[model samples]
Target: MEKFTTLTGVAAPLPIVNVDTDMIIPKQFLKTIKRTGLGTSLFYEQRYHEDGSENPDFVLNQPAYRDAKILVAGDNFGCGSSREHAPWALKDFGITCVISTSFADIFYNNCFKNGILPIIVSAEELEKLLDDASRGANATLTVDLERQEIKGPDGGTIRFDIDPFRKHCLINGLDDIGLTMQKAEAIAGFEGRMGEARPWV
Candidate 1:
């Protein structure tokens, strides 16, 4: 996982509520365990038509939002199955941060694990961010993890709260595997001692 200290980029407005995992990457794209390549398929159904042509109406397919690094979505985002692939798809698509009024518990946890920042804000705050995101190519927003603040295009700021431990993990680029590696020396020492004691067996 990459370290996430601060990020400033265009934000895409996705005002639809109750976005689920299937709606994100779709079941057809779930066979691969690898995280890469899913970005093109992110929101596959909404981003493509029946003939596999690009859908011009989807927010992600629009000219201004094609490269958006942040997403400002409606309430109840990520509200279905506990698929970790959802966050993987989002991160693969260059969206490292997601701001919404509410999110499903499992999806929210998955975001942090995958180096994606999932922010929860008041309904009023979401409206403001959405308004900023509606500005086409000028929808830039800066997310500073250290300060727990979100700076909008017009120089407005919104403060958010996150668990200290999660913040530490993201700042250091420590995933579950990375966390285990931190104890490698101790683990090796214990293994050596066990090997000596079991030599007779």
Candidate 2:
């Protein structure tokens, strides 16, 4: 996972609620375990129409939001099914942070693991961010992981809360495997000691 220290980029506005994992990547796109190519298929059903043509109405299809690094969505974001791929697709699509009034617990946890920051805030604050995001190409937002703050395009700042341990992991680009690797020397020493003590086995 890439480190997420500070990110400043255009924010896409997605006001719809209950954006589930399947809506994000769709069931057909789940064949690959790899995370790299999933971005193209992110929001497959919503981004493309029945004939596979691009949907002009979707926020992501708009030129201003095509490269958006943040997403300001409605309440109950990421509300269904537990698929890690949701965050993978979001990251691949260039979204580093997601701001919403609320998020499903599992999806919120998965975001950190995949190097995506899922921010929970009040409904009024979310609306402010969403409006700021609707400012076309100027819908830029700044996210400071170390400070746990989000600066809207209007220059207003919003504070968010994250677990300190998770914050450390994201700041240093440490995933579960990365965390284990942090104790490599100790693990190796313990294994060697075990082998020496049970050499007959």
Candidate 3:
């Protein structure tokens, strides 16, 4: 996982509600456990037509938003399923953060685990951000994790709250495995002691 301190990048706006995990990557793309290539398949159904051609009308298909690293979406985003692949797809697609009025619990937590910041703000604030994202590639927004604020294009700032522990984890780039590895010496010592005490048992 990568460290997330402060990010300023283009934001893609997707105002559709109830954007479930399935819609994010689609189940067909889940066969691969690897993370890198999933970006191409992110939002496969909506982004591409049945002929596998790009849907020019899609926000991501637009030239300006093609490289967007931030996403401003509608309420109940990431609503269905608990697949971690959803976040993998989002991160792979260059989205470092997702801002919405609300998010599904499992998907929200999964985003943190995958190094993607999922932000929750008021509907009023989200509308403003969404409007900013309408600018396409020019919709660059600044996210300050330390101060918990999001700066919009119009010089407006919105404050958000996050769990201190999660904030610490993201800042330090520590995942579950990374957290456990922090006690590597202790774990090794415990194994050594156990082996010595229970030899031949």
Candidate 1 lDDT, 72-138, residue by residue in tens: 9989999899988899999999999999999999999999999999999999999999999999999
lDDT of 2: 0.91
User: Where is model 3 poorest over a 10-residue stretch in terms of lDDT?
Assistant: 129-138
* Candidate number with the higher lDDT (1 or 2): 1
Give lDDT for model 1.
Answer: 0.95
lDDT values for all models:
0.95, 0.91, 0.93
Worst 10 residues of 2 by lDDT: 22-31
Which residue pairs collide, candidate 1?
none
Q: Which candidate is the best by lDDT?
A: 1
lDDT of 3: 0.93
- Once superposed on the true structure, which residue ranges of model 3 sit more than 4 Å away at CA? none
Q: How close is candidate 3 to the true structure, as a TM-score?
A: 0.97
Give per-residue lDDT, candidate 2, residue 131: 86
Question: Each candidate's TM vs. the true structure?
Answer: 0.98, 0.97, 0.97
Model 2 clash pairs are none
Model 3 residue 55 distance off true place after TM-score fit, in angstroms: 0.5
